[model samples]
Target: MTFKLDPKMTLGYVQLRVQSLENQKAFYKLLGFTIIQESATEIIFGSGSTTPVLILTAEEDVVPRPSRTTGLFHFAILVPSREDLAHVIGNLLEIGAPISGAGDHLYSEAFYLSDSEGNGIEIYRDLPRNEWQVELDGQVNTATEPIDFQGIMALYNPERAWIGFPTGTILGHIHLNVTNLDDAISHFYLEAVGLDLMTNFMDSAFFMSAGGYHHHIAANIWQGVGAPLPPKIATGLMSFSLILSSTDELNKLKQNLLAQNVSFSEVEGDLFVKDLNNNDMIFYTQA
Candidate 1:
């Protein structure tokens, strides 16, 4: 693709329309997020910032995401260090939270879980860049191996109480389940959306990134080919923000979409676009 997003660009808030705001808030409270703001039917929360990174809204008629739908696979939360990761693992264990799985990816270690409403979540810490395995072509070498649960837990001082996600905790990336791999890649590629190809996993998934990071966005066909999108009022991902370092990067993205003949709408200072799966993407400058 002809366009490359600025390396400094990263993900911002992930908004979800849920069926029960009270239940979701109670669940996130266990994960260390402080309520930044709340209303009768919505809540915004983050680890240590006034700028919330997660938003949950309850709509009266919202339904659960239907089967075989193109929507969120997971949203990864990047912790600052391996030790911090261990702390989160420990917290979950202590609270009897259901852990979906865990893995060692060579470049990073991560574990997965689901929220009360079935939204997937990942908690992970990256290996130092110097330690990451990268090919001469700049594609990251990713591996799926069993993580050392014993070793990670060893780093945990059960002596310390669960506080929550650390100050540096941020929304690292978001993964989606699309209807078709080829069509999704066409919409998500470097030239199309300003990301460089980082890795293509086993022909089933594509990982793309900006600024040489492993991935800021990933999509897969693991659910099925030609999966249908959920209803507009489904309880899952509503939209997510991609935060550019400056307005210049946002403008460049606008130009890239125009070149592709893709339709996008700008509201206030933010640009809104939809992917092949009908997932909403908000492109904007950093807060």
Candidate 2:
């Protein structure tokens, strides 16, 4: 934990493999994302920029992820305001999307859903930083209480048309299903990646982040206990990016990774490595 992560760094994008391309594309369209790039095998979507927030690649007849697999649990997309979150809910209601759960963490309000491939997705809005709760140790505390549905609905402006994610919409955070929380914490995240610990949930889940703005990454063994990595063609998470703020930070991480002899690949000048479960994580700095 000696390497101080740059608080400004955030998740870049998430890549998922799907069984059906058109079906997943249709689902994302309903959630208000525009296609930025498309091909026969893959499609990339984003709110406004050429930089994609979500990437879906078609993998036909691949083995579906098992219930207790160690892979993606969910990836969250953070909107700018509560009203934006309301807009997302309103749209989901119109499409009859199956909402899994809704929670008001002390720091944010989030609604969850599952895609056709059973990949979890969360759309949420963060409360202002000034409103967040900080513990005595400079870490944050979060509670999974029920959201105020009435108040959230009140913020929805039926007068305004719901556009795709606003210009500021971002790929916020990612939660993963791992086999061992201790290994993830000691071997990967805290010791090598150098993230700040935020909170621990029942000794089953650990939330960590670069800044104190809540969790940028979380790992849990809720379903996948002592599981192994999914097959290469598994229909779930393909890869994700852990972006760095500067080349110096990226180089420091590279050095740490080398010290541990973690095998990583350099793709187009960016570094990519795999976690213990073999999930690919690319590291790079934004221009």
Candidate 3:
């Protein structure tokens, strides 16, 4: 069934746990995110906007988990422009931070990094929507190519350095490691959620999104099948929540799930479900 989705609607933000408040604060600052609010144990970072992208709370003597576990693969931060990305990349190089990887994903260019505490971070800039190539079936196609590091470096104007992320930028997407890709695709794509399938990799990986964008959610078994979920003691993803444009859309999603016999719970009027990897997800409607 075809439905209309609002492009302005997207992932709101992410709330994460951290072992040390000071270290998390300093780490985020290096990425150009400004501290908007803070308390003794909690600090919120964003682009100086009302909507925060990253929220970190200090925990007492907690241990973090390896990325292989079933938890947040990475939190994507969307930059306003390529120059903005270059500014952050230049700063990271100056500080000697080890980069995990970099790639040009046709629709966007991205650099990957990890914080001192092992939380994954993706700094990326999206190509204009009109520049994206769409297939005959209305599917968006993205190619993996070598990122132009030198070309990006040329835009690294010190005077135009990014002070903070741009407003309206958001979490963008969340990737998960699951035991069974086909099961996950069926549960999230065909049942519980209303996302359209973007691409699938034959029982190994799958990507889905709303409004025809590349992907807001993706799952893969590259880590390993039957891997244990991340322990609650770790500093990592708290949960993922999707905000629908209106109550009608929310009801439609609920009805669709019900018709497909998907199981979910209701928490404070929000539909709650877990992915095949046991990652928590909440779906609620906005006025």
Candidate 4:
């Protein structure tokens, strides 16, 4: 009953609809993401590689998503080291950015912030892989506790001016707000798109990952039970990419979707499927 994914599976670029291009550029630039591609209507940003990690598309007169909506909860950026994480917090402090929350999640230490359009963001570094504790039921134990801010800051070198995201940074995970956990679990995650269950908290939230990492995806009804989908014109998540290691693996998932009778669209060489909540998950293989 192991619900694992291909070892090479990874999260890729996240596309978002933003109210102001300049605002997003300024925010992401300060965080060390460089513009890799740009157009009149869209801009692609990368952490330290040419591959796009975050994409922003222009949305005119976009409405802000309501709190009680089923959509993006947050997109997490995982840096290579604790020192890199400190650099993120340091830069935020220097820019006077408003942080919504900062916590030590047992397995990782993270700081939460939001883009100008209110899309949630988490910048974090994981603890050593060996230190993760798993329970009898095979769920990783994660707790929300205060981060050692002082300790993290002490690692920051004042000699080095704060710059943007480092080379090894990656789009670590995407967490979503869903109306029904059961539907999300069975209809979308397990049956159609395969992802290993990592943890579950009460009946409210659960975490899933591909290759033994804490979580590559998470869903929660934290907004409200049976929350409605945000309007299309709302400034929020558009879609996110899941990079599979090989075309064969991608085909297996495509077959799984077909068997479940899930509607999907194929573009070029990739496939894209929508979850029960209508959130788009794009599957593509790298060369």
Candidate 5:
């Protein structure tokens, strides 16, 4: 099906439940995000403007533990451009933040890191749309190669520092650790949500924006299989909500789910479903 997606409907921000507010704030600050608002139980950090990129809600009574629960995998952040990404990388290096991995995914270059509370964070910038290589079958190609770390660093200009993310930038994607990849894919792609399937591995699934911006949400049977879901008492991902651009898109998604015989419920206009890993995903439309 040929579908067009409204980029404006992309993810706006993510709220993470953190066990220690102090540590979470310090970690994000090192990545150059400034707190935009704060309360006794919650702190919002972003590009230092009104829009927050990440939200941390402190819950001290519950200790943190790793699980296959419906919490967060990692909230991916999109940078304005390659140089902007490089500037952030340079700043990260200056702060001595621990780097987990880096890759040249033909479509984009990305660097990964984990926060003090063990939250995964990805900083990346996409290549120009025209530069993306697609197969005859319309599948996008990505590869992991050595990135030009030094070359990117050279683009860093102290005068052109990254103050905060610009408007139109968004939470590009959300990855989750699920129990079964096929089940998760069926639930999200062919069933409840009508996002086009972008790519897949034996144990992972990727769904993308209608304009084909790689993947907006990805799930894998990696760390969260044969594991228990995160307790509501624990601090982590609460739920992920997808905003559709139009009422037609929302209805189409609902129709598709019915055709697939998928089981779900609606509450106050939001369609809710649990993936194979039991992570809750909610869908709504701006209309």
Candidate 6:
């Protein structure tokens, strides 16, 4: 029951069912996500690399999901440096992008915003590992202090004028709204999915990660326990992916899920399952 995943385990692209592809595209484009691919109903966004990070799919009849439902809370994007992260803040300011909030969470400084479809987004830069505050249990201690905006802006260089997300930008972490905190923490992410419980808030939320790097995924009961799933055809997170390092690591996860009696299906060598929060998890091997 104490299964551990490969340390290199990382998240992949997040797919959201949006209502207005045009509006969402325009918004993410301003944030420096490049359009990697496009079709009649979907537009994919990526950073400097060919790897896609976000997929926006919209149908004519798609509607916004209600706020008090179980779905994505936000998807956090990790950039490589303070300068790049500051550049993003400047870009949003220059374009008049509305910011929901910003935070300096000890280990990282982040800015929060929502997409055109109301899907939450976080753009952040991590302080170096040596700079993080660690607890006696080897867990990282994080807090929400006010970010040093003036200092962050001081790192900004207008001459660099970076056009898109820097090469090292990646899908860092994802937070979700779940119906039950206990089920999500005990039965789903920790035991079955092989993530380690990194740390937790005052019982309303918990952060989980693989290989102990702050939090890779988190869930909260802020909407109240027993929250209902978002309506189908609702515009929000439909699914997201986590890529493992190898087939062996994938097998370990499969065994962990089996041991926990969690149902999963294999399709074309990829594993598919739904979490306790009704969030779709697609696990696949990248190396």
Quantify all predictions' global Cα lDDT against the true fold.
Answer: 0.87, 0.85, 0.75, 0.85, 0.70, 0.87
Reference-based TM-score, model 4: 0.95
For model 3, the stretches where C-alpha displacement exceeds 4 angstroms are: 2-8, 59-61, 201-203, 263-269, 285-287
TM-score of 6: 0.96
lDDT tens readout by residue for model 3, 1-287: 54433344487667788888898888788767788789998888775475667788777867787666777678788877888788778877877777889999878999998888877788888999888877788777766789999999998977764556656566778776766665546656645576777767465667778877788887777778776777777878776777788877777777777776777888788888766655567777764
Model 5 TM-score is 0.83
Candidate 6: segments with Cα more than 4 A from true spot: none
Put down candidate 1 lDDT per residue, 1-287, tens digits, no spaces: 46778789878889988998888999888777889999998899897567778999888889999978889999999999988999988988888988989999998899999998889999999999999899999899898899999999999988776678877899999999988877546665656787887988898888888988999898888889888888989989988888899998889888888997788999998999987767688989866
Please give, for residues 128-154, the per-residue lDDT of candidate 4 as tens digits: 988888887778988899999999999
Clashing pairs in model 5, backbone N/Cα/C closer than 3 A:
47-164, 69-230, 71-237
lDDT: the better of candidates 3 and 4: 4
Q: How many residue pairs of model 5 clash at the backbone?
A: 3
Return the number of clashes found in candidate 3: 0
Model 2 gets an lDDT of 0.85
Give the per-residue lDDT digits (tens) of candidate 5, residues 1-287: 52233444576567677788888887777677778889989998766356656778887686675555545677788888888887778777776879899989888899999888777888888998889887777777767889888888889887765555544455788887655555645655544455656766443445455556678877666664554666666766755667778777666667777766777789888777665545556677754
Whichever of 1 and 5 has more TM-score, that candidate is 1
lDDT for model 5: 0.70
Q: Report lDDT (Cα) of residue 66, candidate 6.
A: 92
Model 6: residue 61 alpha-carbon error in angstroms: 2.8
How would you encode candidate 6's per-residue C-alpha lDDT over 1-287 as one tens digit per residue? 36787789999999999888888888888888999899988998897687989999887778789988888999999999999988888877878888989999888999999887788999999999889988888777877899999999998777776688888999999999988887546767777887887777778888888877889998889888888988788989988999999999899889888988999999999999887656679999884
Instruction: Choose 2 or 6, whichever is better by TM-score.
Output: 6
Instruction: Evaluate model 6: give its lDDT.
Output: 0.87
